[model samples]
Target chain A: MKVRWRVLGGEWQETDTEAKTVGELMASLGLSAEEYLPSIGGKLVTEDEELKEGTEVTFIPVVSGG
Target chain B: MVSCSVCGKPAIYSAKYEGKAYCGEHFLEWFDRRVRKTIRKYRMFGSKEHIVVAVSGGKDSLAALHYVKKLSKRVPGWTVEALLIDEGIRGYRDVTVKDFKRCAEEWGVPYRIVSFKEEIGATLDDIVKKGAEAGLPYQPCTYCGVFRRYLLNKAAREMGATVLVTGHNLDDEVQTFMMNIMRHDVERLARLGPVTGISGQEGFVRRVKIFYEVPEKEVVVYSVLNGFFPEFVECPYARLGFRWDLRHYINLLEEKYPGTKYMILKSLLDIAEAVRKGKGGTPKRCTVCGEPSTKDVCRACELKALLGIG
Candidate 1:
């Protein structure tokens, strides 16, 4: 299945992945679940959330800098 | 869906550290209770204190301001205001400042802005440029951190704030603790706590971190749920510091092993308390600026001399 993901303020890019859930997707991307809050369709979601084909996920970086 | 620990509603947050999940309503209640517990445990403030929230127009600080403002409405004689330090970063600080103003007005909290250009005679852009031109070893964060701290303290004092509040959460604290340990800077570790700085000291406003025990992830959730999350903006110079890399590694550990961050924080507090117990000497006044300092010239003044700015 293909899922769309992007960091906030960045362009969304689609990736074909075998990952079944948000936690798996984050693991595949080498992103820490603690650092990014995944949102689907403008609502925040937990890692157990299943990913569907063409689901757009915006990963909001929770950590602020400086 | 995970059920809320309290009421079995669909869980909105799962706090792995505590082995509990909270639905939207319960999460807010839990988060607020934690905030209150932290404040009470630390004795952070009296009932009648004036709070100056040092906001950077980011999610963390803005969230801190929002909660504090919400809290002060019920506490008689408590007043809440915001103070922002504009480091004058070309693209970042400008955008965040707009968000700050909008939120302040909407929340009915009075706010003041201090800029590096006005206070230090140069914007952060200029400071970075000059540092590069002079072959200075200092990174952008160093200059920004020193000046921001100097201004926040000075501005908060001028505003008659009895206490200054910051939005620093668990992740920031643990990262700093590890950094200090790696650098062998144990004395700085002594300063980390829920309420920091030398209390009852002249020229120093006590700094309180209400979210000292809250995780950054929870902070983001709190802000979003409360409808006050600021527009996300990354500091342009954030990647230049050791902290950037360190933060990622720490978060990775936290992701793999739940409660890693909390364990680190516990270690930090214990170490800090031990260090505090052994400390007794008073801080000296900066010769040039008269701010509380350990050296004759404070870091801010030292930077000013290096940049030839006021």
Candidate 2:
């Protein structure tokens, strides 16, 4: 399974792993999804969301944005 | 020695009337009373026009509205209008706007909200997303400042406000000055005053600063001592890049040169008097709204166009 991580509105990079959950994937990348809100399939996914093949994860930084 | 939270000047010989400590120039009672006095002293309000204050639901803004409204009853000709600009941050904007509404209702001032969604068709979050999408050279503070200013003026115009008041106190002023100077934009550096109303200017609303003289540390102490505002240090995006750097640098400068912020602003005020006396920044008419603009299309319209709105 290809686990991928990306910054929202940014480039996505592929991870060479069969990570079973978002938690595992984040741990692989040495990050916490709390601070960097990760989303999958247009809905925000928590750390418990089990990863499938080609799971596209996005690390959305805490944004005040304006 | 208690250090001034604003200019970083130490209060070597001072008294604490509670947890609020004050130097001679910054005594909390004197600061509060004088700020309340300057509003009346200058007669900045009118009988017919609404005294609309732009609030960010922050500690400073809440205090500003409280004082302004407190004085409005005493002043007679004045009434308070609380204006909150919703920048369209997801949970953040919702929280602040709700707080503003609740506070206004409690205080009995007419409250109105102008959201970025309706006004600009896009939120600050959208702008940030798009910038990240484009990998663009954009500053978050730039977008925030531009959007906030444009919306505040638009809201003021819509509300038919005579004078628009903001929660900018001494520290905010000094930080702005330091930022302008860092960018070598001396013109804005010279324009820091309580009232930023360009005289003889049509279509431009006057920006009166009631906190022109109040210090930021004093504002904080006053807010805390008075239970006027919620001191939430939990802005998610506050710790982001650049502006944080600028803030830290300003604090460092204030530490190195005590009273640097106030001294710089005091001198800038003198310069503002002269610059304001002379024809100021190029004020042209916006082709879209006919309001005062530096360009044919004002920032609001330009932003709307950029975001495919309005």
Candidate 3:
């Protein structure tokens, strides 16, 4: 399956992976589910949320400093 | 699809810490109730009060403002206002400030914006450049943090606010706790809790963290659900601080060890309570700015002198 991922402020890029869930995709990309919220198809979803082919996941960072 | 733990509707969020899932409606109810519970537990507000919400156009701060505004509508004598400190970070603060204005107006909450350039005689960008040129041992965050806190207290006090509210969640609290412990700054640790500062301090406004017990991820979820999530803009200088590194590492631990953040917060509150029961530190007035401080000169004044700004 292919999943498109991007940080909130960055550009989206595509990656082909066999990751089945949000948690798996996060692990595959070296991202921590604790630090970022994955918005799949414009809605925030849980880690167990299933991914479909070419699902766009925007990782919104939860922790930030000013 | 996961079902809502309560109503059988489709669930939008799974509260891992509580082992429950919530639909949009139940989640808001749970979150708002939890926030109110924290307020009640801390005795955060009076019957008639003016709250100055420290907003930065981020999810946490905006959600703090939104929730406070919603609560105030039920109390006739209570008023909520937004206060923003413009640090003059070109790309970052600029974008967030626009969102701040939009939300404040949309919610019908009056707001005040205080700029570092106007108040401190230099913008944050200017201070950073000058500090670098002068070989000052400070990061951009150091200057930004001191000035922002000083200005928020000063502005809130001037606005006759009974209390100042911030959007600091559990993740922030734990990270600061670990940072303070690492630096052996126990005095600062004593000052950390849902409520901060000595009540009725002459120059300091009482500060409360409404989301102190809430996790950062929940804050994001709340903001998104409430439609208060602003454009996600990362501060340009954010990664330069030790805090940025600490935040990432702590989050990693939280991901691996599910309840690590809450455990850390529990320990922090325990230490803070024990220290508070022992004795409170005497507050000193900054001879330069006359703000409450530990030393005769406050950190803000010290930074101003280092940056060669008035």
Top TM-score prediction, candidate number: 1
Model 1 bad stretches (over 4 Å): B279-281
Residue-level lDDT tens digits of model 1 in B44-131 = 8898999999998899899999999999988988999999999999889989999899999999999899999999999999999998
Native-to-model Cα distance after best TM-score fit, residue B158 in candidate 2, in Å = 1.8
**Model 2 chain B — which ten-residue stretch has the worst lDDT?**
B12-21
What TM-score against the true fold does each predicted structure earn? 0.96, 0.70, 0.95
Prediction RMSDs, each to the true structure: 1.5, 13.4, 1.7
Interface RMSDs of all predictions?
1.4, 17.9, 1.8
Query: In DockQ, how does model 3 score against the reference complex?
Result: 0.64
lDDT of 3 at B155: 95
Tens digit per residue, CA lDDT, model 3, B53-110: 9999988899999999999989998998889999899989999999999998899999
Instruction: Show the colliding residue pairs in model 3.
Output: none
In angstroms, the error of model 2 at B264 is 1.3
Q: List native contact recovery per candidate, as a fraction of 1.
A: 0.62, 0.00, 0.64
lDDT of 3 by residue, A1-66 (tens): 988999888899999999999879999998888878888878877778899998999988877546
Q: Enumerate the candidates' DockQ scores in order.
A: 0.68, 0.02, 0.64
lDDT of each: 0.89, 0.66, 0.88
In candidate 3 chain B, what residue range of length 10 has the lowest lDDT sum? B275-284
